[model samples]
Target: MYQLTFFLEEFLAQYWQKKPTIIKGGFKHFVDPISPDELAGLAMEEEVDSRYIAKKDDQWEVQHGPLTFDNTPEDNWSFIVQAANHWHEGAAQLVTPFRQLPGWLFDDLMISYSTPSGGVGPHIDQYDVFIVQGSGKRHWRVGEKRDDYEEEFRHSALRQIKGFEPIIDEVLETGDILYIPPGFPHDGYSVETSMSFSVGFRSPKKQELLSTFADFVISNDIGDVHYHNPLLSTRSCNGAISEQDYHDLETMMRSLLDNPHLLKQWMGEHLSQNRHELDIVPSDPEWSNEETYQCLMNGDSFNRISGLRAFYHDAQPEIIFINGGQYTLPDECADTAKQFCNEQVVTAKSLGNAIHHPAVLTLLTQLINLGYWYLVE
Candidate 1:
């Protein structure tokens, strides 16, 4: 496991989502967790989201994977695999240090292998990211956020911006990190063949939240209440919508948001979903609660699937959200629920006597059968 050398509090206060900064030697004597060849193999998997961006014939070219590197240019090309942490255990460890930030905000760990002079070009992301330098070196240029930065598409799938004045221009060696907040325009090219691990934090857009909330309301049938005026008043102009009518309608809609239960349910369900595919393979002959418990007692351990999102709201301690589903356990098992949500690996000793509880055992068995957690064979 990699440890961060910097102070989290200081970085959070000064740079997180506020400005861009480079932390030299963020991981002292860093060693890459995955190699370029491994990354290439991952890109060849059809279920993985991978891509190749290269400059060929003085024009930017983009190719969606499953990709082949045959006849690929030695220079001026990069291969990127999204959510590598989900499929690669070693790559997933890179995300552990960033858990200081909210887990729900995390999107995925994107690993990129670049050849010399290779880059995706100057572009702005809507989410914050920590680009960790691994293996060789990379020259990066980050600019201040601008309102008038014009977007120019080099390819149909590639969205880049016109060059901007650089506030930070530096070459990052292995173990160095570059932190860029949302809206900052930045570009990086490999000084040599290199690997970069980008841990991204996603911020949901207003429209996305509203649209999801609408879906939640519709699915739950919670906002079926209709507008009613018990005390009717005559209107001089019947064609025009009255201010009072507008206020009443708006209040009716906003009431859904005001309800704490509805808000918690929607937030839990929405945030628990992984932004990328999870490497889920359900147990071939599902284990029953008794069988799972017996295995645990016999010293078997369970590992939470990488990139599986599970969390609980403080307001509803008994309720746990896993992947897009919600479950309510007995209040006594709330701590166990929290443990399962927080821990990446759970051994029999770690769970203690909690595993003996019928409700907790059943829940764990169900989760294990669903392939969210697997026996460490």
Candidate 2:
């Protein structure tokens, strides 16, 4: 199990999104949950998002996967697979220590296996990442924050920046962690053959918000109110939109913002949605309400699929949004709903009256059958 050497509150207030900080031996005596061979096996799978990057004498190349290492040389290359937690139960355990943060803000776990002198080159990521060294050693150099750096792309899959000066340069051993915030140029190369696990957080861009909101508006049948002006005054310039017109337009736009209920629903649905594909398979035989309730009473537990996004809003207290779907709870089952949203593991004991609530039972049964939530065997 990974252990934190420093306090989370202090780390969040001091360094999160503001600067880079390295915690030596963050997971003291850390034993990697997944091995390099396991990671390489995942890279060959069709559904997994994997990449292979190689650098040879200043020339860099990148290849997208599902890939195999049969034809490629072993040295001077790195193999990366994204959302390992979603597919492997062992990889999912790595996420246990970081649950103190908001559940919805989590993106996924990305693991990389690198050979000697292997790296992806200097690049800037727009999301926060906690890069944990799993095995062997890696030398990391993190540069200062700069948005205007020119990018050089040798291949369509790779975009790299030139000449990054280090703000933090160190060799990280097994269990060491390096935290880098958004827009900070950073690069990591294997001092030896190494494995690194990255726990990343979501930072949605403005364009993404606008695009997803447009979809939400169309789907929900909201924001359809046409602008109507009851008071029309004579204007000197017909082409000009006067201050009143601007104000009216702004108010019309703000209608989406002003509707708290609608905004909450949209956010709940949007935030819970996953950007990557999930390795979910519906149960061949669906669980019935009676079967689910009986299992709950029999002391059977439930585990949420790792990397599953779940959230609730204060404005929509009874609704638990998860995996792009909304599950409404009874007033009596609100506490239970919070547990389901906040926890990766769920027990029958913590459910209280939710187990007996007919609507909640039905919803749980459906989710279990759909494989979003599974019965612990």
TM-score of each: 0.98, 0.95
**Residue 62 Cα positional deviation in candidate 2, in Å, after optimal superposition:** 1.5
Per-residue CA lDDT of model 2 for 1-377, tens digit only, reads 66677788989999999999899988888888988778888889999999999977777778888988877666899989999998888998888888888777789999999999898988899888999998899999999998788898776777778758899999999999999999999989999999999999977888988888888988888877888998998887999989989999999888787887777788888999997778787887888999888888898888888778889986556799989888887777778778878877666687776778898888788888888988885
- Model 1, position 211, has a per-residue lDDT of 96
What lDDT score goes with residue 46 in model 2?
Answer: 93
Q: Rate the local accuracy (lDDT) of all candidates.
A: 0.92, 0.86
lDDT of 1: 0.92
Q: For model 1, how does the per-residue alpha-carbon lDDT over 1-377 read when each residue is reduced to its tens digit?
A: 79999988899999989999999999998999998889999999999999999997769989999999899988999999999999999999999999988889999999999999999999999999999999999999999998999999778898899799999999999999999999999999999999999999999999999999999889988878779999979888979998889999999988888998888889999999887998999988999999988889999999999999999998677899999999889998888889888898887898888878899889888999899999985
Q: Candidate 2: where are CA atoms >4 Å away?
A: none
The lDDT of model 2 is 0.86
Clashing pairs in 1: none
Best by TM-score: 1
